[model samples]
Target: MTRRVLRTLLPAAALVWTAAVGPAAAAVPLPIDAPLCGPAELERLDGLQADLDAKAAAGEAGRAQYWYVDPRACRLSVAVLRGAEDAHTEGFVGAALAASALPAPTSLTEVDEPVDRRIARVPAPAQRGARAAGTLHGGSAIYSGTSGLVYECTSGLNNYRPGTTTTAGHCADAATTWYDARGNRIGAVTDWRYPGTDWAVITPVAGWSLPNDVLGSTVPVARFGKASLGEAVCGRGATSGTRCGSVTAVNVTVNYPDGLVKGLVRSSQSGGEGDSGGPVYDGGTGLGLISGGASSGSPTFFQPLTF
Candidate 1:
């Protein structure tokens, strides 16, 4: 019965929070041509981000995908879904900054695409062992219960910490059990941090061996590293397959309908649903986990491994 229900509905685990409020101050939109932010600016931006989130909850302005401090432009950068921006947006941004006693945002970029958790629910295929990287590659399916409900997410790196692997926190919440492509009970989510961060560690069930290699790659993950601006990168997700792009920004704060996630790695790579928790790497070096992105062909964000 559970399988039947899961097979029919697309279940995505996300939380939503909303509030009501008033008008904001007036401001103008700035162009996006600045450099990425450094440490000091990132600190200031973090506090300001909290203020903006409060305004969003109070309905002072529409919700945003995320916001960050662009060091090059030396101003705040706010990202919203394409066509959602309007006159009131600028005002709201100005007001939010004033309330926080922070500098005004320099620009508001409309994300031509939408950002979302990469998970899908479809009919179950034949179950198999988790060792087959090709069949159960990075952008493969993750099953949660005996029911047909399954989350299509990209596979992350092997932690080598005995019976553990990594994925996006939103993919499997704490205490939630997961299964591999073959319907084998993988393990329960042991630890997870969301809203602030977006990564989770899963412990495999007894008798299951966790592989060191990513789903689609031939090289075994050696270690994790930090992402730099203009650094070449690539990501593998179940929905969009594998796509590569460059790191555009770091230390970003994304405001999902459910809540806010900070310290994200922004990139030019595009990803879609079912890509969450996939590995973001540069060759053999693991960098981060796919958090969300603009549709399937626009800039996406990831939860950095170092964070």
Candidate 2:
């Protein structure tokens, strides 16, 4: 029954988040032309981090947390309940949790924060903008290049050939072209499979060298086991960031805008735009990529990494 459902549904939903509403294509490496953040922006992010630390210190024990970004301000942020006892530590670690099925985000919006209470507001990008780099939504340091049209989320690692790193497929679909901050072509999409599988491996037209800590310090890619229903899993992505959720269903089939792919795992966690190709794993084992999810619901689907 589970296999039957998954075989039918996972592919159509591939471009759900970004395709539903978002920006355009790839560009240069992030952080290069990225303007240094000002004191006010730094303070705001610091406070958010402090608040998360406070919660963790207060013993709020859960693998979930909050994520916020103001594309207008070019600010990306995350808040995790402190002392998160997980062995995974690639930045964007906090985004792995905190997706709520409540009031859903319909469009790509920034988060704003009030002086009091933990209020997150989305900031509008300034007229003169640059790239935004930070830990990935899947717990690694990541740099994103801005193409005026879209934000290209780039990672410094790849699972296919260890040591090969590049950006997400969503970025490719959105980008007209890609380059290094130095204004050099890095690579274009040699191949990409969306709705079917979240993983898109790009063969750089030229050799590309990536930073080691792009997402977080080096954490080896994990291995996976056949998942069981109701299994607990931890995951991270370039866009939606990092999060932890349980397997809501196994072998569930989904329909994406494109063709279909199989071996899906579903979760109740929330993932959003930019997080499309993130990795979902069980502790030390890798599972899949962020396939697609209900923009306003709890069903987060992943295309198994193995497939």
**Candidate 1: misplaced stretches above 4 Å?**
1-47, 53-61, 83-91, 96-105, 128-140, 160-162
State the lDDT of candidate 2 residue by residue for 1-307, as single tens digits: 0100011113423211211112222221234335645666645544444444444333341332333332223333232223445533222232222221111111111112101110011222232423232112233322233234434343423534443444444444555344443334445555555433445554444344433222432455554456655678755654455667897555443333233333466777666644555566665565665656655424576656553
Clashes of each: 13, 61
Model 1 poorest 10 in a row by lDDT: 1-10
The alpha-carbon deviation from the true structure for residue 88 of candidate 2, after best TM-score superposition, in angstroms, is 44
| C-alpha lDDT score of every prediction, in listed order | 0.65, 0.41
- Regions of model 2 farther than 4 Å from truth: 1-146, 151-157, 166-186, 204-219, 222-226, 257-261
- Cα miss at 169, model 2 (Å)? 5.1
* Number of colliding residue pairs in model 1: 13
lDDT of 2 at 130: 30
